[model samples]
Target chain A: MATVKWPHFFHFSAPHSVVNTPAHRPDTRRSKSYGRSCVEPPSLFWQTPGHLTTLGHRIPTSRRAAKSHNITTKVDPEQVALLIKNEWKLSHVTPLYRFRHTQLKLYSKHLAAFIIAEKQQGVAVEVGVEAGFKVTFSAVLGIAETKEDAETVFIQVHSKPLFSADTPKAVWRGWLTCVNGDPEYLRSLPPDFVSLPLFCSSGPEYLTALVKSWFERTFDCSFGSLYLNSTMLNWLAALWTGCHPTSNIRYLKLAWNMPSQPPLDIAYTVNPQDAWELWNSIHTEDSTDDRINIEEVQLFMNGLEIHFFRHFKIYLSAGTLTKVSTALGSAHHDGKIKIGSSDYITTLLTLLTECALMKTPV
Target chain B: MDEQARAILQRVIRKIPNKKLQTALRAWDHLSSEQLESLDYAQPKWLFLENLISRCEENRLSLKDVTKLEMAYYIDNPSKGTWHAYQLFQAEGDAVSVNFTQFREQLKAHLKDVVRHVSVRTKKLEDGAVWIRIAWGDNFSKPNHLKPTYVVHYLQTSYVFVLNLMSKHKPFLYQALLLSTRHVSIKEAQLSSRSLTAMRDLLMRQYQQVFPTNQERTLKERNAPPSHPSIEKEHAECAERRHQMACEAFGDGVLPKLETAVYKLETKYRGNSNNTLNDKDELFRGVVMFSSSNLLESFRHCVSAGMAEGPVTPLLSSITQKGRNSFVITDKVPGAASQTPAHKA
Candidate 1:
């Protein structure tokens, strides 16, 4: 028989095993039976066959056998690392585990780089990511110190569209790479990150509700002044954020572009108490020092009346008499109230005269 | 008498009714001898014959009576021949003599019946004449020709007459008639333009005697009851004055103003047309065209040379201005007025 050399193995005595026992003695009979049955044992369980074995017995029979037999061979530590790195590159490694390790390292590096780059760029960042979506990548971008110093940066990535759409996983992976590569580039993004569609949206109601929830989640963050254009969305955000109490939102703009006939109902969603609170805040603040201009207030009032007349009436009642008078005068000056009928003109004139008289020093 | 003359005379007598002839003749026969003698001979003779025949036809007398009377008057008189010659001469000179006698007989008969009817109808007016009064409303004036006239007739025993009684003032009568007729209620009887003119004319005519002189009363002065006249006359004058004022005010100027104002109001409010006046704005244009030839002659009757600021002034001015604006005064070509001959020379 030709002598065979087995692969090198490390050996050590069992920590708790007895040295001599009749059961532990080598059984030649069992060994011959095991040889006749060529079926290999499970790789992990294969220890020593029939108590004692020749060196040839320890060696693998074929190349496939050698693969199974080599499991016990002591692997070099550097070689293991190299092997893992190579596997990651091939993408055979599970993406979750790879993401976990890769984002953590990228986050640390980008966080430092973003902090330095944000100082140079006057622009802001807006990051939006939903959970279970690109949130993994967003989380990495959000952690960057440079992204934090941005004048106005939003980071939000919705998970539902990214995961559920027909997009390939590779595309998301590519997005993840782009987002994580540079936080400085993201901070230079334009103010209007998302362009609104020309036509009215069917999903405004849904989007409004989501935005309300978002406003609530982000209430504590320093978002500065928010100008929400949608009437319903702004109203809902105002309610959910609870910023009315503290007046954190110094300026709010609302736009309503509904048709003239069958005017919209805005009172249903807006709370009277919230409106009163907003009006009271406006009154308590010095009119000269107000950040919101009179024109902006008029625009807001116009939108309110257009969308919700009843709510606007209530708002007017809650508003300061001075402001109400000013608004009424402005309305008359603008010819917003059509002077078609004699009776209507008389009624308007009466109301204006009454208001003017009431404000006069008696 | 000639046979033809006799036939014509008989035909005329037949036209008189029997009952009227009987009454007339009896009155004629009852005439006292002194009265008959006091009458002119020719007239008495004609009357006697006419009455006698009329009585016979009425059956109050027989033909014998007519014959006896005629023979006694003609044959018994010795100068009968001369009388006959006078009668023939009168007949020849007058063509209507035969018919005149017959008509006289008929008038006598008619007068008798009228007198009897009046006496029976009005015992109080038996001795004198019974006067019948006729008054007409404004609208009736046009058709009836509201003029007062006296109709007199003498019967054997009494006289019958008809006297038209209306407002002494023509304008008063006209307005009163309009007020009484056109309106359902007294309030609605207020005089309108057309009625006003009629009333003014009526008043001016009717009250001419009371206000004879120009110094008698001016429009405003006449407003008060006349102090110079008796109470009854004063009341009449006052009533006349009021009627006149109403007519003049509503008719002369106010009505035209009111019409224009109503037209403007309708245009502004109701959006309707005023078709009451025949002389609409268009007619004024024709007047202007005619008037343009002799300005002085055209304006001769006009109160002023320049247009007065009145109801029609604005309309006239607007028309005049529009005409002037549209009028193009170009240089007259050599023979523009005379058209060139169709057959070129």
Candidate 2:
């Protein structure tokens, strides 16, 4: 009955301490309106439907349970690269990098808040911070935590802050090589470096390489669990999986309402021709006891259009199904039909029949 | 009858066209002695003379119809200048003799066409008036966008006057009046009864103001009769004064009455419940009524003064009473009763 934790660790820092303290400091003036009061912890953990497991609790490690937990974790370097390559195949990777750079540039002009979350305990912690702050409290906190646990930390010094500022190109080149070329060097860096809110004011591809290198050098891990929000994690996972060529990453959940403006163009990596074949493969592989995850099925259906119906019919013919109507009826009950399809009427009729059978008082 | 009177009568007859003069002579024949006296001829004893002179001038009556005795009667009345003048017009010429005869005929034809067009245009106006009355009763009515009350009022008043005048002077013109009122409801036409009464009152008031009897006249007039010093001048001045006064009184009284009657009728029939009388509609109705009434009165004055056309008295009487009575009867029972001889009689 333990609730699943989102597989992300978040490090948050604001210019002013949001925490309320009664102590008066002459240098730092306090405002009464600064902090919100914390609510009391619930009496029972499982009483609430949406509560996550408490810290230090063991997460379910079974593949099926883990997959259902809404987090994808990778423990191998080859697999991480493969995922990244797959993401690149699926989207226009260049535009993604360009967009990331633009966001960084725009955010640099204001008082910024930064958060970095790590998906795994010992995998290199991800580092990110807003561009402008006189003193980054997060960097200071990391230093303090490192000092407290010096015996457990091993720090590999790559580009110091001064070197990054003075010789940026050289530092960038070195950072890139350390991340993409030398796995051992990347694995040598301390996990605390990940905890430090590092500045990334460049393209997303560069930032991705830097982060991956930092993790490899710091923890000798190619990929552990992703610790970013759904969008970033989806992009990185797709990249690792080699599902697409371009890295224009789209997280299905986040895609519902993203981009303050509508995207100029949207491209899907899944071929319209292959959609029917893929759908048939899923049905053939799935057992009566095993049900298709409705979400993946819906996403697949979203990419299909009228052009795929002919191929889909062919796929249906190849399968040893009783009557096509019965098969479609069951499929329709499962909500597998795309709502916006031109064949909505036909599909809806089939779906109704399927739903009736499923709910036939058995 | 003297030879001079016969020459004058001949001269008058020469001035008038034959056809019109014939009609006038026929009308004269029908008049009683009192009616002839009311015309106030200069020579009373020369009645036959005046009558013969009037007949000789009538263009409508052929010379073969007149006896030598009638011509001899005309020779003796030397002082009957007014009668002679009327005969002159009657015997003047055919339609070609009068400069405006052809034009008048054209005008009549054009007017007939206009009557057809206006019937169509005025349908909405009449309907609007009816609707206003049905909706709002006698309360103040708003002007309609399609047909303003002022225009409709003017058209109705003009139409009634024209009918009256045509029936009196030229019975032929009655056809046009009938055509004009073809589509007008019996109720709508009867509304003119109120207008006619108002007009009669206005004319009487005007006549009294202009030519008051010696008793009712000013002291100055009594002190200095027509025989007194500057008698001719005084008479001229008095007539002028009377005319001015009549004009003013008619303008003030008759015009407003016509406007009020039209407004009341429209309000009783077609006014919208929500709309109230706007100042523009009131001003427009006032101006139109005054102008239309003035036009009719001026035309009547011209006839009375021997300037233009036939007398309007017969036409006015015919339309105002007969037409209005017919409207009342038909309006009372619009269907079966209208068809019955009992109602028609």
Candidate 3:
């Protein structure tokens, strides 16, 4: 049924609980023991369900907020600019089977052909720059924090309508990445799979669906929307507000929505320095790791909510923290994100990945 | 009829609409068919009640018989109040069972032995739901039908759905349930719904639950879309695996309808020190709740449509596996709190 070498179809034959790292165990060093997975391999995919087990899901117990950095100097500035500009719709992709970063150019041709073919039933359309929709798949290099981490794959679709300009302009852009992905989970894979857990697309739903379908067919992976809830939005807000000292956040802007009889929306803006001062007042860092706890983050948000309540006579926490934006970038609770700057991209993706992992079935 | 019994009967009959009187009486099946035919159900509610009380008086009905009619109404309207589910844990490997008669005797004996003036009545529905109505009284008062707790449990399953239970009587009720069912202890299962039957159907696994199977999924060649021969699916294996995983995590077809899943986090605030919640002596408590018109359906779509990555996380899967939606996360492991009444996940 597939163009890949394997004829027989394989499903999640991997045990839900692949390895017991004790990484999430409170008070343990939060390092993924990469060597352990190599020593004790997950029961092979070809193995029976009887072999499947649960050591418990690999979710982190604690995490630190994103610190400011200059990612453009380390990565391609063009890629950084492209990433920071578009408000990408986020989804989590299952591990891709036999996806090789070295062969993205070939993948590009195949995907473009597949998309064109799907769009026009049996029409003979030669897929390339001349084609109405030209797809380009490139390796966004230097995002992988470990050897096990696969190079991020960036995809762009250029559209040139029948009577439009001669030059084909980019109509859509997306990327699949795993920056500082759970090393244990990446290592646990049988080596044929690429664990790119985060998928972000900026395009029309129609074209995005086609592209996703192509990726699903070609790579044999699945994608699910990753909705960033209000808690996550609050996390983003506090984290970005913390970055104001290093890189001016301009103004900390927050939007909230509560389901009242008439429905209410609150858009609160605070001076970057004021938000930063409030964050510092509540965010006490006694440890050398310079980490911020979930409690402190919640407290910082509470301080804002209380302040808002004191002035406006309405509790903001009653509604959702729908949107949080600053000089760094903006993120919506519905899972759309504009990077604004590449500095904290890893931090955002890492948090998203962790949040994604928390959805494991009971 | 006894004065108390007459008042209880009057109130019970009044609660039922004029139209449902016949069906409710038939369900009660206490009054003779001839006597039922003799009365006028279409008369004013007060007249109807007075008429019914005279008939009961002529029959010399006891308090117990009057309670039967009240039970009948409650049994008909199982949707009277909100029901919370609790799972019973047995100490040993072998699960224990009790027949209807034995359970009734044991429950009545346990409650009567504990409280002097307590009134406990048991009735079994056709679908094996044992409905127990208990009226409580303090040292000075007689058992009051005005305030009664309804306990519903399927004889075979471990769940007990209680409606309007007083916290003061919880340990006593738990004791009775444990003795009646031969289970050791009971803990809140944290699942609640307005419909008692919904809770029962969910915990009892009345609906189908999908599991991973070795059967070949033969995709009909006719269903394939016409394609330009140049493009082909390189990784059909993954698509198949994800579909199967989705089905396994969330059952195929119409998913179970659960409106909410709440988690009360009482775990220690293990964080960077100097945080107010990081008190070593006291645990930090927070509630994370997910609500939708149909929560399980939403989660199923989240899994099937690829909003949630596979293999499904234990937290979401715990909904079906634990047959529960509410969880209390404590000092134990993060996933452990959602497992069962007693066993940690």
Highest TM-score against the true fold, candidate: 3
Candidate 3 docking class: incorrect
- Report residue B74 deviation for candidate 1 (angstroms): 99
Give the per-residue lDDT digits (tens) of candidate 3, residues B96-154: 54789898999999988887789998888787888898998767788888788999888
Per-residue lDDT of model 1, residues B322-342, tens digit only: 211011112225868321111
Q: Candidate 1 — what's its lDDT?
A: 0.24
Candidates in order have lDDT scores of: 0.24, 0.25, 0.70
Q: Write the per-residue lDDT of candidate 3 for residues A253-352, one digit (tens) a residue.
A: 7877654422445566666766676687687766677777777778878766655443223445556788888878898888888887788887887777
Candidate 1, superposed: residue stretches over 4 Å from native: A1-98, A101-235, A259-362, B1-345
lDDT of 2 by residue, A1-362 (tens): 42222111111211123342323431121111111112222333326444332211321111110011111131233222211211110100000011121233333222112112222336553355322222111111111112211111111112224324643221111011011111222122222222111111122344345444444433322332211223222222221112212221121111111111111111112321232333442332333333334343433332221111211111111111111111111111112221111111222222222222222111
lDDT winner: 3
| C-alpha lDDT (0 to 100) for residue B238 of candidate 1 | 48
Model 2 / residue A259 / CA error / Å: 41
Report the CAPRI category for model 1.
incorrect
Rank the models by lDDT, top first. 3, 2, 1
Top candidate by DockQ: 3
What are the TM-scores, per candidate, against the unseen true structure?
0.13, 0.14, 0.45
